[model samples]
Target: MTVALWCILIAFLLPYLCTYVAKISGGFRLKDNHDPRDFLDSLNGLGRRAYAAQLNGFEVTPAFAAAVIVAHLAGNAELVTIDVMAVLFITSRLLYIICYLVDWAILRSLVWLVGMGLIVGLFVVSA
Candidate 1:
């Protein structure tokens, strides 16, 4: 599979990673599994931020996946370019999560913009 395709997989999985962070840090337990949403909702500080990040990850992943797939379907942009953008998006998301966890609001917003730009750039390059 192409690197971009691999990135789609990574994007899909990233939110779960964030949730795991929330779980581990938030003291989630088996009983919490019965009401996972409530458990996550009850988190504070880093755990809360991590949960927020996970939600954002889920929100953006589909667009990123669609952009990658559409770019591939268009077949106008070079595969390398698409791959690079995908990698950058993933990197930006990782940074975003870190920023969110540490309460770096401004930096996190900047990183989010960068990720969105990468998504748009994929489509632009394909055109």
Candidate 2:
């Protein structure tokens, strides 16, 4: 239950926090930059990726939590397994965001695939 709550919080907060981090580090300020367009573009890109990852997390949590909760209600909750998968999913997404930010082509793609597989695995195993 706690994990689920944390997952929800992280899922929601990661994007906002990541965007803020990127914006501040990318020269964001109260005043507009000399080239406002470029600054906006940079911020937009960072925000987009953060949003994409957040969407992925959102997609996973409901299904994952529902499966785990339903199973528990039915006397078959594999709490540890669900928790492990949840942790893995979150960690992999963090790795993914880093890789995406750095433009690490190969490693990013590999981790992306693994992250997808992990989500699929959650569904598969839950059933």
CA-lDDT, candidates in order: 0.94, 0.61
Candidate 1 residues lying further than 4 Å off, grouped into runs, are: none
Model 1, 26-67: lDDT tens digits are 898878677777776678998999999999999999999999
**Model 1 worst lDDT window (10 residues):** 32-41
Candidate 1 versus truth, CA RMSD in Å, comes to 1.0
In candidate 1, the residue pairs with backbone N, CA or C atoms under 3 Å apart (3 or more residues apart, or in different chains) clash, namely none
RMSD of each: 1.0, 4.6
TM-score of 2: 0.66
